[model samples]
Target: MQKYPMTKEGEQALRDELQQLKSVERPKVIEAIAEAREHGDLKENAEYHAAREQQGFIEGRIQDIEGKLSNAQVIDITSIPHTGKVLFGTTVSIINCDTDEEVQYKIVGDDEADIKNNRISISSPIARALIGKEEGDIVVVQVPAGAVEYEIDQVQHV
Candidate 1:
């Protein structure tokens, strides 16, 4: 099994979801299935089928979360001593050389990548290009939109 690199917060989020699914959703679905079964014929019961479908979905999600948490490699960004280079879990400030627009992004795991939150996946084109590069270095990232140039302004391990 390949280990997933994730932040502490991402691991906790998965654990919390797993707990909710097992404790709250699983029992609720069980109750629903029981109530629907009492309604009579299994062949023509819509409620029974619906409850069973919901049960499958809930169980699958529970298993998925459990598997991820079990094989995850948790990383705490604040503790590492980085040498002024962009690294995993480090936030980087960059400026588009051509457009001269400034933007900031924190390199995070795939599970925690949220563009709206300024978090990007380590495997992303921009992140891959920025890694191991220090401040004042210019990087060219290949995206679907073509090659874009960026100058690193700062790298913070926060």
Candidate 2:
């Protein structure tokens, strides 16, 4: 099995979701299935079918989370040495050379990448380009739009 990179926070979040699914959602779905079963015949019951399908979905999600957690290699950010170079979990502030727009992005695992939160996956094109780069280094990222240039202004480990 391939070990996947995941941040400490991402691991915890997945664990929390698994816990909720197992302890809460799973039982609720089971109860719903039971209630639906009590309503009518198995052949003609839409409620029973829906509830059973929902149960399958919940169980599948639980299994999926468990598998991911089992394969996760948690990367703790704080323990990493405060190097100026861009690394996983380090935040990079960049300035768009063409448009002069500045944006800060934290390179993180795929599970923790949320564009709204300024966290990007390490596999992302921009993050791939920024890797190993240090402050004051200029980076060019190739995207669907085109190749865009950026100057690394700061790299923060935190």
Q: TM-score: which candidate is best? A: 2
Candidate 1: minimum summed lDDT over ten consecutive residues — where? 63-72
Root-mean-square deviation (CA) per prediction = 1.2, 1.0
Model 2 C-alpha lDDT per residue in residues 1-158, reported as the tens digit of each score? 88888888889999999999999999998998899888879889988898889999999998899989999889898998887899988889999999999999988888889999999999999999999999999999999999999999999988
Model 1 agreement with the true structure over 1-158: per-residue lDDT tens digits = 88988988888898998889999999999999999999999999999999999999999999888888888889998788878999888999999999999999999889889999999998889999999999999999998999999999999988
TM-score of each: 0.94, 0.96
Misplaced by over 4 Å in model 2 are: none
Q: List the residue pairs that clash in candidate 1.
A: none
**How far off is residue 71 in model 1, in Å?**
1.7
